[model samples]
Target: MFTGLIENLGVIDSFESDRFTLSVLNTSTTSILSTASVGDSIAVDGVCLTVESFTDNSFTVTVSPETLQRTTLSEKIKTTNYVNLESSLCVGSKLGGHFVTGHVDGIGSLVNYISTNKAWEMTFAAPSSKIQEWSNFIEPYLITKGSIAVNGISLTIAECDVSGNWFKVSVIPHTYAYTNLHYLRPGDLVNIEGDILGKYVEKFLSSTLKSTKDRQSNINSDFLAEQGYQ
Candidate 1:
């Protein structure tokens, strides 16, 4: 799990068919290398990647075909790019952001950006059909005032409508200056991991309801009494 709060912006030193290499390219970055170890989970642009090895200021992880199909990792490698990085959340740590699983639900592209007196507003255009179709899997967790992780950054959903199947987020100057969001441009793809709590709640409700419906007798007091219901 993660808080969607980016700890550092790492640069892609190199990428291959299965292996990826990243290094601390930002001098102002404060993420500690000593605190990391092999086998630990890290969020690389919202996609959970396990650290396979480390040397110097760089680390490596192998990407699976499924992850490549679901995230911007492949696109980034083809374009030779930098990526946002965050370590996993630990107990007793400050919850700076919303709960993020580092699991990309879908890929979205930057549509536009504008500067506002309060904050920078950005819109991302994704496959409307997919987001709406997956609403059953994601909507219950999304409250009007709840949170979501966009490219590993915790952001609030200013507005979400079914008609456009799109959402918008506002970024303060600090987030814009400290993260890779500033690098986003029209048509640039990003990895999106919806709030984790919502996913679990959706699953639990669906399972319980489905099971109760399937076992119709399990719902009646008479049937429950046969099983020692009090």
Candidate 2:
């Protein structure tokens, strides 16, 4: 679990078929390498990648094909300079942002970005159809004021299209300057993870209702007579 608060910027040193290495590129927060150890979970662009090995200024993780297919990590290897990095939430740590599982549901793209006095209004076009190439899951449950993670950065939805094709977020200057969102272009794809809480609730309710209907007992006249209720 993570709070979606970016801790540092990691410059990708190398990306291969299964391995990804990055340096401890920090801007404001404490460098993760200061305390991170092997097997520690790190959110690299919204995907929870376990640290396979490390050095004073660098760390590595072995990525799976499924993760590569679902996140922007592969696309970013050829484009993005720095990737957003965040440490997992601790027991007593501050929860500045929403709960981010670091599980990328699908990839979305930037539709537009505009500067505003209050905040930078940024819009993203979500994947509409299930692209089997990816995890093939694009269920947008984002409500107005609900939280969403884009490239591992938790943000609140400002305006979402009813069709779930796109949504907007108002990012403050601090957030914009610190994370990899600054490196995004209009068409750049981002790792997207919907709020886990909402997803679970939706699943629970749907399953509960389905099971209830499946187990419905029909009380016909013949059944009532057999039960001595006629």
Candidate 3:
């Protein structure tokens, strides 16, 4: 689990097949190397990846084929890209941001960016979420003023289309400058994770409704026996 708060900006070192290596650019290398161990989970751009190896300045993780198909990491690997990094949440620490699972649901495209006097209002167009898939579940939980994790940065949805495929977020200058959002361009893809709480509620409601419908339509032998019905 994570808090959606970025801890460091890492320079993409190399992506050779399954090996994804990154080096600390602005953050302290010695501190990270000393603390982080192999098998520790790290969130790279909202994707939870396990640390396979590390050095004073760089670390490597193995990316699964599923991750490559679901996230923007494959694209990030093509060029020299800076990715947002956040360590797993520690117990007893302040929850600065909403609970983030570092599980990318799917990819979203930046549609537009408008600079307001106080913040940056950005619009994104997520793919249609008719079924449950990463990047395909946004519609169920894309609520206005609800939390979302985009590229591992926690943000609140300022507005959302009723269809749920498009949404807007308000980004303060501090958030824009500190994280990788500053490097974003229109049409660029980003990893997205909706609020977990919303997902849970959606699942619960769906299950309850389905169960009710099934019970109404089908006769259950156990239920009939309990009710003394032949």
Cα TM-score of candidate 3: 0.88
Error of 3 at 166 (Å): 0.4
Q: For all the candidates, what are their Cα RMSDs to the real structure?
A: 5.0, 2.7, 4.5
The TM-score-based order of candidates, best leading, equals 2, 3, 1
lDDT (Cα, tens digit) per residue for candidate 3, span 1-230: 99988878887888888998899766533334557989998899999999998987789999999999889899898878789888888899889999999888888889899999999999988644323553357777899999999999999999998878689999999889878898989988899999999999999999999998877745589889889997
Which one wins on TM-score? 2
Quick one: best lDDT, which candidate?
3
The 10-residue segment with the lowest total lDDT in model 3: 127-136
| lDDT value for model 1 | 0.79
Q: How many backbone clashes can be found in candidate 1? A: 0
- Model 2 lDDT tens row, 107-205: 887879998886889998754443442233544476789999988998999988776667899999999999989888797788888889888888899
Model 1, range 114-217, lDDT digits (tens) per residue?
Answer: 99997998876565545653454344454555687888899988776664356678899988877899988887888777777777777899999999888855
Per-residue lDDT of 202 in model 3:
90
TM-scores, in order shown? 0.84, 0.89, 0.88
